[model samples]
Target: DAMVIQNPRYQVTQFGKPVTLSCSQTLNHNVMYWYQQKSSQAPKLLFHYYDKDFNNEADTPDNFQSRRPNTSFCFLDIRSPGLGDTAMYLCATSRRTSGGASETQYFGPGTRLLVL
Candidate 1:
């Protein structure tokens, strides 16, 4: 089935080390998104790519960055991992309606990160 896929379902990284998490989809959706979710909190939208155009949330931290080189794949890069940065990273895909208001996002299982 066509769906979003996130690699290395679990990750462990040292403080100050850089880590990259990846997402890919086979649904041919027009948008791909990355979200950061901590325990007991809602997932926060970090940014998204609508085709080649990138849209980032205003409150998204400078430490969180994303790259979508093509339609099917996207990556999240953390320059320096911190204990507070540990969270489940979610990847989602969506397609806009012609009216641009009724779209739904499909999310991957998510990749959990643990800071050491």
Candidate 2:
């Protein structure tokens, strides 16, 4: 029963509208990550918070942002969702307390967004 939970598996919005997707984990992991995956392509890392240390991928667009206000919860915010922005938003976590790197990341089922 202890796992990540994401509200509303599907989201539909108009282009340019702001949208938010949420994630919460019961794993008590120290690192939480957000990824954007489109059409079965590789999940692109957007950003992550490692114990309040936020790391964003270099090429990730400015339209994407994240907030991890607490240990258990994280949110992905799209300032302006575009048609090309439609994708599955995935949330992941790792304990990663031993060092700065960990290969195993537990992922949420994901939130699918459709921009019209």
Candidate 3:
């Protein structure tokens, strides 16, 4: 199946500690992205890689970082997870097709992090 995968649908961590979340895709897409959704807010793009080219959303916080070691995998590293870091982290992928302004992105179930 050409889909995104996220492990540990739920995660628990203490405040001020570091946490690592992951995502993988079987779609053979060239772009992979990480987004953070806090409560009912929109999924804000944290960063992404365009076939080894890393692009960070301007508004994304400094505490968030991502790495795509290869085509099939990527990792998100939270250097110091604060209380506000607790939220649903999503991994997404999309093929840069010729869709007009609405190329759909496929998402994984997400990893829910709870900071205590």
- Please give the RMSD to the true structure for each candidate, in Å: 1.1, 1.0, 2.1
Which pairs in model 3 have colliding backbones?
none
- lDDT winner: 1
Q: Total backbone clashes of model 1? A: 0
Model 1 C-alpha lDDT per residue in residues 1-116, reported as the tens digit of each score: 99999997999999989999999999999899999999989999999998889999999888888999999999999999899999999999999777775378999999999999
Better of 2 and 3 by lDDT: 2
Instruction: Name the 10 consecutive residues with the lowest summed lDDT in model 3.
Output: 95-104
Native-referenced Cα lDDT, model 3: 0.89
Better lDDT candidate (1, 3): 1
For each candidate in turn, the TM-score is 0.95, 0.95, 0.91
Cα lDDT listed for each candidate: 0.93, 0.92, 0.89
Off by over 4 Å in 2: none
lDDT per residue for candidate 3 within 1-116, as digits (tens), equals: 77899977999999988899989999887788899999999998899887798999898889888889999999999989999899999999876655523256889889999999
- Best-to-worst order by lDDT is 1, 2, 3
Q: Identify the runs in model 3 with alpha carbons over 4 angstroms from their true place.
A: 97-102
**Rank ordering of all candidates by TM-score, starting from the highest:** 2, 1, 3
Please say which candidate is ahead in TM-score: 1 or 3.
1
